[model samples]
Target: MKFNFDQRIERRKTKSIKWSSEVLKNMFGEEDLLPLWVADMDFLSPPPVREAMMQEVEHGIFGYSIRSEGYYQSVAKWMEKRFDWKIQKDWIIFMPGVVSAVYYVLQGLLEPGDGVIIQEPVYYPFKSAILDTRCRVINNQLIEHDGRYEMDFEDLEEKAGDPRTKLLVLCSPHNPVGRVWSRDELNKVAQICTKNNVVILSDEIHHDLVYKPHRHHVLANLKEEYRENIITATAPSKTFNLAGMMSAHVICENSEMREKLRKVLDKNHIGMQTPLSMAAVEAAYREGEEWLEELLDYLQGNVHLIRETVKRDLPKAKFSPPQATYLAWIDFRDYGIDGKVLEEKMVKEGKIALDGGTWFGEGGDGFLRVNFACPRETVKEALERIAGVLNKEELK
Candidate 1:
């Protein structure tokens, strides 16, 4: 099916967290700020997903629902087809979301004050989950050079070797400064984690949205021992824009680890899946592949649009095209403003809402994360507003 991704859908009055004025006010201290912040896409989900949900809704029976065998098979098939990572259906466990799973893993697997390792300037929730669970965060900051980011194995090895460190949260095809990790890079990570007995929680949520010429490697599929020690958290939420559905798939080949994580989830009473969500998950994996391919093509176009606009208009900023995900990480350190100050200017002067670099933890200052999964026009307008503020300051 040919999808018209260029069509802009109005979301302002729809009570969307991304588009709601009240949400903007709460998050950014302004109700009318133009939004491009949240990770959810502004684009409509694939037609098959919508059609399946509509069909489920029309049935009019809303009760506790279970994911069918087909649901697990769909996830398994997508893994193999997209990443060439063959995973069995039995390893799949369901969760409401990836962020929540992090907390549960912390609660279930580690003791208070036990250390958890996370790469810096990563998805902020990893840090939040650690602190909330009373665990100390061990930072393995990524090396940034010439606008490219690489995992610092030296720092990572040093941190992982800490006897108190119990888990390492790996954001494969990492967030913010996007980097689809190479297999060789992943192998070294496995080696270090294995030597120190650190279990990996691989968040491969964006595994399917990678741009061409770059591929996503499922950490579990790399080696048998890696598979045994890794717990993977994935979802159709980001891939199919089903975040509101609150469904996630946690895959673990290690029975012992899976049981530990599962116990926490059971204690919290998290097994119910909405009927609509079940249908959506099945349809997304089985029928949405064609739509996803087109979305990636459109997303790549959005990436280019932001790259060129930042270059031509926001001359003081540095942006390298991300290798994966719909987020573009732009560096404003070229302007020499505090990261916090630049974030405020983005809202007050540029009249746009973006994720401040500091939100991602260490090394985020003087940077911003822009969500580019919306219509191209929205991205263009945001860049123009930022340019106005920066250029006006430049002339002063």
Candidate 2:
């Protein structure tokens, strides 16, 4: 069945965080702004997933659910088929979400005051998890040259070498600034962490959304030697728009490391799944590939639209098209607006909600993370609103 990517589904009345009046009012100080923030997509989930979920709803029995062997197999099959990682069923562990899994890992593996390395500008939750776990954050900031972001492996090596740095939270196909790490980059990271005995938690939630000509390498898949040191967090949430399902997987190949994480999960009572979410996740992995392929094409078109709109309207802004994920990280430094002021103008003047760059930590200033996982028309309108704010005579 052909899906219509241009269809604008009504999300306002629904209990969508992305479209929530309260959330917008609190975050942006305006309830009526056009929302392009939050990581979840505005599109409906795959038909198979929705149908599976409805089937469960129609059954009219929500009880304590046990994930079947088929459930694990589906996840294993997806990893094998999509990324050719050939993961074993035993390697897969469950968490409600990736962020929760990170917390569990930190609590399970490290002592308070140990250091965790994270690259910035990155997903802010990594920093939150580190600090909340009572660990120090060692920032290995990504280097951007001419709008392209690359890892500073020299800095990573130095940071990883710190005896206090016990874990490295890596965002593969990184968020906000979306550069899919090449195989070489992944190898260097693995080598650095492994040599220093620093456990790597690779958040690959955006793994499946990478674009053509750039492939996402599962960090654990790079080498067998690296497997023991790497823990990967994945989910159908980002891939299938199943965030509300609250199902995520953590793949740990090392028996000792897996057991350590399991203890944390058990201590926190973390392993539980809704019957509907199980059905949805299983169907999504087993049958949603066609829908995903179509969605990617649609998203690519949206990316192009953003590029053209930014170039034509916001001439001073710099937007390098993301190699992966639907988030567009655009630089507005040339406008000479402070990061806080830029964000304020975006809410008050532009009347649009965006993930401000400052929220992503160091090097994020004077930027905005625009989620373009919506209709092309919506993307165009958001860009127009942004242009209006930045192009204002007073700002210039």
Q: What is the TM-score of each candidate against the true structure?
A: 0.98, 0.98
Q: Provide the overall lDDT of each model, using Cα atoms, as 2-decimal numbers.
A: 0.90, 0.93
Flag regions of model 2 displaced more than 4 Å: 394-396
- The residue pairs in collision within model 1 are none
* Candidate 1 per-residue C-alpha lDDT over 289-386 given as tens digits, one digit per residue, 9 for 90 to 100: 99999999999999999888888888889999999999999999989888899899989998899999999999999999999998888888888888
Residues 144-185 of candidate 2 have per-residue lDDT tens digits of 997899999999999999888899999998998899999999
lDDT, candidate 1, equals: 0.90
Residue 115 lDDT, candidate 2, scale 0-100: 96
Global Cα lDDT for candidate 2: 0.93
